[model samples]
Target: MKKVSKAIINFDDYVERKNTDSRKWSMAGMHEMATYVDDNSIPLWVADMDYKVPTIIIEKLKKRVEHGVFGYSIPSEEYYNSIKYWNKIRNNWEIEKEWIVSTPGVVVGLNFAIKAFTAIGDGIIIQNPVYPPFKSSILNNNRVIVDNSLIDKNGLYFIDFEDLEKKASNPKNKLMIICNPHNPIGKVWTKEDLEKIGEICFRNNVILISDEIHSDLILFGNKFTTIGILNENIINNSIICTSPSKTFNIAGIPVSNIIISNEKLRMEYLNEIIKSGLKPIPSLFGAIAVESCYTLDGLEWLEEVKRNLENNYIYLKDYLKENIPKITCGHLEGTYLAWLDFKKLGYSNQVLNEKLEKEAKLVIDPGEIFGEMGTGFIRLNFACHKKILIETLERLKIVFGK
Candidate 1:
C-alpha cells in the first residue's frame, strides 16, 4: 500500500466530479434536477459528500485493485475486528463477533428486519420528516404505516412521545425504525429521548430498528446514543443498522453491519437475507475500505472532515441569518445535511422547488419527499468545498433576498 499523507489538507480545495458518473453531478445521475434546471446548475441534493475519500482508505483499495483478478470474496477476520474496534473506541459499544451481520447497505438491512419481524397487513411505526426510505420500506412490503410525526417548534424538532406511545400501542404495529443524528433535520436524540422510545417499543412489543449510519458524522457537542444500549429488553428486541459508507463517503461501495444481540432475532434476519439469495460478504473493495477506515489514521482524517463540516455549517447558518433572515435553519446537531425552513417565504413545495432549481440555478432535496410535514423546507447537502457552500448561499439570495 502507498504511504498516507500526514499534511493537513485544505477542505476548500475543489475536485472536479463532472463526467465521473457522480449522482450529485451527472445528468443521468441527477435526472430529477436535470428536469428543472440546465446541466450547468449546482446540485446540493443527495446525502453523499463532494469530498474525496480518506487517503488511507483509497490507498488500501488501490492495493486490492492492483491484485490481478476480481472474484467472489468473503469478509476476513480483520473486517469484523475493524468494526468491533471502531464501535468500541468511537461509540463505546462492545459486541461479540456473533452479533454482527453483514448487509449490502443499511436500507437493505432495514427491509430484511421488516420482513423478518412483521407480516403483510401488520403496522410499522415511523417518525415522519425522516429518511424517505423508512416509509417506502414499510409500504413496499405491504405493511401499514403508522406515522408518529416529530413536532417542530420555531426551529427545533422534538419526538412527540405522546403520539409515539399512542401509535406503538396499536397491536398491529410490529416495528419502528429510528434514525439517530437524524437526516435532513439533524437532531441527535439524547439518552433520555432514546430510552423513552425504547420503553415505548418495549411496552407495545414493537420491534425497534435503529439506523445509526450517521452516528459518526455528529457535529457540534451532541452525542449519539444507540437504542440497543438503553436496556436488555431493548437490546434483545432491537436491530441496529450501522455503516462506514456514509461517514467515509463510500456509498458507492456497499457495506453495512446490522447488529442484533439476540440469537433468535439474528437467525431470523439472517434467514431472510439467505431467502432473498443475498450473500453475507460485501463487495471486496468495500470490505477493504471499511477495515482501513477504522484505523487511527482514518479517525484522524475524520476529525479533520468534521472540523471542516462544522466550519461550513457555521458559515452557511450565519450567512442566512445576516443576509436572508426570513429563511430559518435549525441547529445542525449532526450530519452534513442542513434542513432549512422556507415556510416563512410562503411558497408551496412545488413552487419552492421550482424557484430553487430555475431561479437560483441550484438543486436541493425537496423537503416534501421526506414527508408531508417537511413541506416548505429544503434539505441542502453541505459536505462540499466552503466556496461551493458560499456560492449556494449566493444563489439562495438571488431567489429569496430583497
Candidate 2:
C-alpha cells in the first residue's frame, strides 16, 4: 500500500519502441507479421509492456555492467534469497532455496518438465484458447494434447470440471499444464478452483505444471493462489513456472524460477536441464534484474502499472460499448492483455487480418493462433500509455464501426 515516487514512474509517458529490436514493436518474424504488418502501423500485439521497468533494476544492471567482467556467472545466495522473500511477501507462500531451479525462460522450463516427467507418447492435458506455447511444447515433445477446454459463459470463462475430471482420470494422461490468470481470457483461477483442480490431478496421480508467469498482474480485486500453497500431496505433485519478465517488463532478460518441492521430481528436472547442456546458473544480467525487482521497490512500480492497465481496460470496454458495439470485450481479471470477440464482424480470420492491417493499420494477435476456441477473438495488449491505448481504440472504432 506504499505509493511509488511519481517523479520516477510515469504511466502516461509514451516511449518510442520502433527500431529498438523489440519484437512487440517490430512485426518481422511474428506469426502474421509479413502478411499484415506495415512499417507505419502501431503494435498492440505480444505480452510485453510499453512502460519502463523500475529504476532499481536499471541501476543494479548499470552497476553490474561497470564491473566489466563478462565471464561465466552463477546465481548468488542473494538471488535465491530474493526469490524466497518475494514468494513469502507477495504470494503468502513459504519456499526454501533447495526447491528453486533457474531456467532461461518459462517456456524452456515447460519443455524440461515435459521431457523430465512424461514419456514421449504420454498424454499432457492443457486448457484450450490458452497460450499457444502450451500446445506447441506438448506436440513438439511428441506428447498427446488432452484439451480440457474452458467453458465460456457469456464473456467470462469457467473450467469444465466434469470434462477435466474425465481427462485427468485417463491413465495415459500423465501431466497437466495450467495457466493461472489464464491468457487471452484473463480469468484468475480462485483458491477453490485450484483446490478442485489439485484434488482431481492428485487423485489421478497426474503431475501438474502451473504456468504462473502472469500471477503478479492480478487486477480488479482478484487474488492469485500459487499452486504450491495447496495441500501437501498436491504441492508435492506440482511444478511452478514464474518469471519477472511479464510483471517487470523484462522479458528480454531470459530468466525464470521453476519451483519444484518434491526432491525426486526436482532431481529429474535438473537431469533434463543438464542433459540439454544448459548450465543451472542464470545469466549475469538476469541474476541482477531478478534480485533487484523482487523487492518492495519493484512491487510499488508494479502496483502503479496495474492501475494503468485497469484504467485502459475500463476505457477499452467503454469505448467499444459506446462506439463499436459489435465487438465484445471479455472481462480482464488479470494480465494486461484484453480479449475482444470479433465473431459478430462476420469475417474469416484472413479477412479480419486484412481489415485490421489495411484499414485499422494496427498489429494485434489473431485469436486462432491460441486455439480453435479463439477463432474470432483477438488479443490486444493494453499495457501502454493512455494515449497509445486511445489511439488503438480510435483505429478500431474507425475500422470496426462500419
Candidate 3:
C-alpha cells in the first residue's frame, strides 16, 4: 500500500460550482430545490465529496477540453478496458468484455434493469435505510416496493435473513435490489448475506439487480463481496451497476457501466438503455476520471479517504457518546454518509427539521425523506476537510443545547 500524495491541490485549478448552476451547491439555494430548502447550511447533504478528482483525471479532462470540437465522441478500449480490468484486479471478480454495457449512470441502469425483467405492477424488494434512489427507481418505474428493512443493533445494522427470505419468497416480488456497502447505514454485506439473498430471490423467481456504486469505498478489514462472485446461481441471476462517481467524485460526468453476465438479461438491459436515450456524453470527463481512478493514483487516495473517514467516525462516536449522549447513530463500513438516530430526541420529522435548521445550522438529509424506517435518523456527510467536520459537529453539539 503506497501513500497518496497529500500535496495541496490548488482550489483555483478546480471548477467552482457556486455560479455554474450545479445541483450540489446550487441545489441548496434553488427555489425549486426538491430536497432542501433555501438556507445557508454548508452543503454536505449530497453524496459527492469536496476532495478534488485525481490530478491525472484532471489533466486528461483539460487536454480533452482543449480539442474544442465538442462533437459526439466515442471512447476507445481504454475506457471500457479500465472498468473490466479494475473490477477483475481489485474485486477478484472476472467480468467478460461482452457482458459490460455503458450507461449514463447506475440509476439509469437500474431503470433499464427494471424494464428488462419486470412488468409495471411487479414488486421490487429493497433494503431500507438504503440509497434513496433505489426506491425512486422502483416507484418511478411503477413497480411495487417491498422493503426488507435492516436490523440496527445499537449503532450497527445487519440484514435479517429470515425476514428477507419471507418477503423475497412472495410470488408478487419480481426483483431484488441489493446495495453493496449500503449508503447511510454503511454495512458491507457478508458472503453469507449475499448467498442467502441470492437463494431467496432465486426461489421466488426474482431477478437481482445489485447496485454496487459504493463497492470500492469499504473501510479496513471489510472486503466487498461483489454479487458476481457470490455463486453461479446469483451471478447468472444478477446485473451489477457500478461507476467512478462515488469513489472518484466525478459524479457530474455521470457515466456508469452495467456488467451483466446473463446473456438474455444483458441484451434486454442494453436495449432499454438505448430506448430511454438519457444523455451520455462521450463523457470524456467521466472516461478520464475512470481511467485515473482505476489505473493510477486512486487506490492510495481511496486509502487516505478511508483513513480519514474512520478517524472522523471515531471522533464523532466518542464526542457524541460523551457529550450529546441522547442522540444515537449506527455501522459505517462504507460510504461517506452516517445515519444518526434522533428518535431518542423525541422530535417529529417536521419539528426535527425546524430544530436542526434553526439550532444546528447544519444541512443534513432529513430522515423522513429516506422512508418511514429512516424516520428520526438524520444522514450526515463526512467527506469534507477535517476542520469543517469538527465545526459541523460543534454546531450540532450546541443544537443539543446541553
Which candidate has the highest TM-score of all? 2
Q: Is candidate 1 or candidate 3 better by lDDT?
A: 1
Which runs of model 3 end up more than 4 angstroms from their true locations?
1-17, 29-39, 278-282
Ranking by TM-score: 2, 1, 3
lDDT of 2 at 129: 92
lDDT (tens digit, per residue) of candidate 3 on 85-114: 788877998888788787878887788888
Task: Give the Cα lDDT of each candidate.
Answer: 0.86, 0.90, 0.77
- Tell me the number of clashing residue pairs for each predicted model: 0, 0, 1
Reference-based TM-score of each model: 0.96, 0.97, 0.91
lDDT of 1 by residue, 1-402 (tens): 223555245675798888888877863455242466677588788888988877777777888889969888888888888888889888888988899898989999999999999999999988889998898899899998888989988889899999899889989899999999888799999999998899899889998999999999988878888875678987888999999988988988989999989999999999999999997667788789888888777788789899999999999999999999999888789999999999999997778888888889888888888989888888989998877888899989988998
Give the C-alpha lDDT of model 2: 0.90
Q: List the residue pairs that clash in candidate 2.
A: none
Model 2: CA > 4 A from native: 1-7, 32-34
